[model samples]
Target: MLAYIGKRLMQSVITLLVIITIVFLLLRLLPEEGYLGAAAEKMTPEQQEVYLTNLGLRDPILVQLGNFYSNLAQGDLGKSITYRTDVPVVEIIADKILYSLFFGLGAVVLALLIGVPLGILMAQMKGRWLDRLGTGYIVFVVAVPAMVYYLLIQVYVTDFFRLPMLFDEDRPISWILPLISLALGPIASYAMWMRRYMVDELNKDYIQLARAKGVRERTLMFRHVMRNAFIPMAQYLPATILFTITGSIYIESLYSIPGMGGLLVDAIQRQDNAVVQGLVLIFSSLGIIGLFLGDIVMSLVDPRIKLGRGESVR
Candidate 1:
């Protein structure tokens, strides 16, 4: 198990390195000649060189890449060229990542809170009206696009309650809409899928044995059926998490929320190659981290997933 975990760790590191290197090369290859603009053009050539130097743009490509990795190894993400304010990339990511995390996690958890038990009930009541109602909800959730749902909430719910658009000056409104937007897809998917599979699990011999032992319906559902059901759902977590992350760019854009999504969008519009590269690296890392954590948790629950040496679920 330890060996398996160690192997996965090494692979994740290599994958991250490759991604960062590709981003570096792509940024250097782009046609833009180092962030030319009204502000940049105002500087004399000497001043421009000095300005670029301060941002580490003066170094050779290889040296710059080396320095980036070296600093990154020491937990220092380089300063943004576009922000031009000597703000570290990690610091920026730290601020925005929490928002992304808030939205992604809040949505997924809420979806599961509602979707899972509903799926279970539907599965148990298969062919009944409640099952049909649950299935209808699953379909309804899938039919509506997240953007449209977000627009509806922004217009009707916000307007009706006369509530503030977002939570505060810095944070968005309890991150509720963004969370729901990210969650609905997975929630719908999980309900339809888990319902079918969990029903099958409940029909198995082990479940029947548990039921025959006078186990209450709730106990049978929570203790026996849930564990079996979770193993399958656990496999979905990595993909579900990545999907939520990718969708946030769209959600944040729709809401005008400032996050990594907005940062990336702004960087692209302004042709700020440095910030663009930095943001992509950070976002990619977030996905990888989620996958890694999911694998660790899966290992704990099942103990069959071994990814490296000297690594365990604990």
Candidate 2:
């Protein structure tokens, strides 16, 4: 297990370096004008040269990339180009990432708490009213665009309940609507997947064998069926948890949550290369790490599964 973990960690580092290189090269391909927004546009030619030169934009691409990695090794993510020019990119992200993380964390917890039980109930009560209800909810959430729900919540729920529409740091109640919007789709997804997998598990030979052995119904349902059925679902757990840090673009925008989503949008809109590159690097790293961690979790959850060789015990 330790060897497997060490191998995965090494692979993750290599993958991150490759991602950073790709992003750096892509950002370099953009025209010099791309980095200059309205704020930079007002500067005279000499002043602009001075600014770009100071940013090392005048350097060769290879040199710039080298410098970027060097600074990255030292924990410098560069200053924002369009936002707070004096503020480091990491500092800006640090200030806002927590709000998004909390919102995402809340949404995931809500989805798991509600979705898994709902799925188990649906599976246990197959073809009944509970199953139909769960199926309907999955369909409804899948068919509707998330934007519509966000709009509805902002327009009706806020007005009817007299709750704040926009997020306020000091006002915790403002979090409710955004959290709901974010959780809605995930809840449907988790419930539907859990139900489908559980149904499959219920029909397996082990279930029949367990029944023949006179295991209690509850034990059969949870201890046997649930544990086996959840292996596939467990693979997604780490990624879902890590995504809280990335935040939902739509929900953050709708709630004005001052999270990573909004910051990314603003950075792209203003062509803040430094901010954009920094954010992309962070996101890419998280995505890679999340997948690696998910695999580790899946292995741990099911002792039959082996990581390095991709082998499993029957």
Candidate 3:
């Protein structure tokens, strides 16, 4: 297990380096004006050269990359150029991350609480009205473009619930819409996967033998089917939960929430290259970390699934 963890950690670091390098090079391809900001228009040619020189932008790409890595090793993520000129990227993200964290955690908890139960019920009630209703909801959520439903909820649901259409930090009621919007997709995902896994478990040979031995249906479903089915689901929970906590870009933007998602959007619109780069790196690292943790969680949940051994129960 330790070996597996070390291997995964090393792979994650290499992947992160590759992503960072690609993003850095791509950002360089963008017009240098992105680094100079609106002030680029005001500066004389010599002044622009001087400014770029001070930023080390005039350095060779390899040298700049080396410098970036050195600073990264020390926990400096550079500074915002356009969005909040000269502000440290880390500080900018710090200001916004808490909002995303609060709403994202709320959304995930809401999703798991509602979705898991809905899925269990749907699986148990297969071929019945309840199952059909749940299936319809899953289909609707999967088939519809997210933007359409997001707007509809913002308009109609807000009207019906007498809730604010946009998020307001001080007004708890206003938080409802964004949380609901953020949770909807995850709820559908969790419900669909849980129902599928449970249904699969129900048809397995062990479940059949248990049924033949006169195990109560409820007991069999929960104790045997759900327990085994949840092992596979555990593998994905960490990644899903982590990604959700990173914030939903569209939902945050639509609800006007001041969060990491919206911050990225604003940075892009302002062409704040440093901020964008920093956020992208953070997001990439989180995704890799989530996946790494998911693997460890899966092994812990099901001891038969051995890591670094090329063997798994399923």
Best by TM-score: 3
Per-residue CA lDDT of model 1 for 253-273, tens digit only, reads 767666778778877776676
Residue 134 of model 2: what lDDT? Answer: 93
Please name the candidate that would achieve the greatest lDDT relative to the true structure: 3
Q: What are the candidates' C-alpha RMSDs? A: 4.1, 2.1, 1.3
Measured with C-alpha atoms, the lDDT of residue 52 in candidate 1 is: 63
| TM-score of structure candidate 3 | 0.97
User: In model 1, which runs have C-alpha deviations exceeding 4 angstroms?
Assistant: 41-60, 166-175, 208-219, 238-247, 303-314
lDDT of 1: 0.73
| Model 1 worst lDDT window (10 residues) | 305-314
lDDT of 2 at 252: 85
In order, the Cα lDDT scores of the candidates are 0.73, 0.86, 0.89
Tens digits of per-residue lDDT, candidate 3, 1-314, equal 78878888999999999999999888878877777777888999999999889988889999999999999999999998889888999999999888888888899999999999999999999999999999999999999999999999999998997889888889999988888888998899889999999999989998899889999998998788999988888888888887997758888899898899999999988878788889998889888888988888988888888888765522
lDDT tens digits, residue span 101-129, model 2: 78888899999999988998999999999
Error of 2 at 274 (Å): 1.3
For candidate 2, list the clashing residue pairs, or say none. none
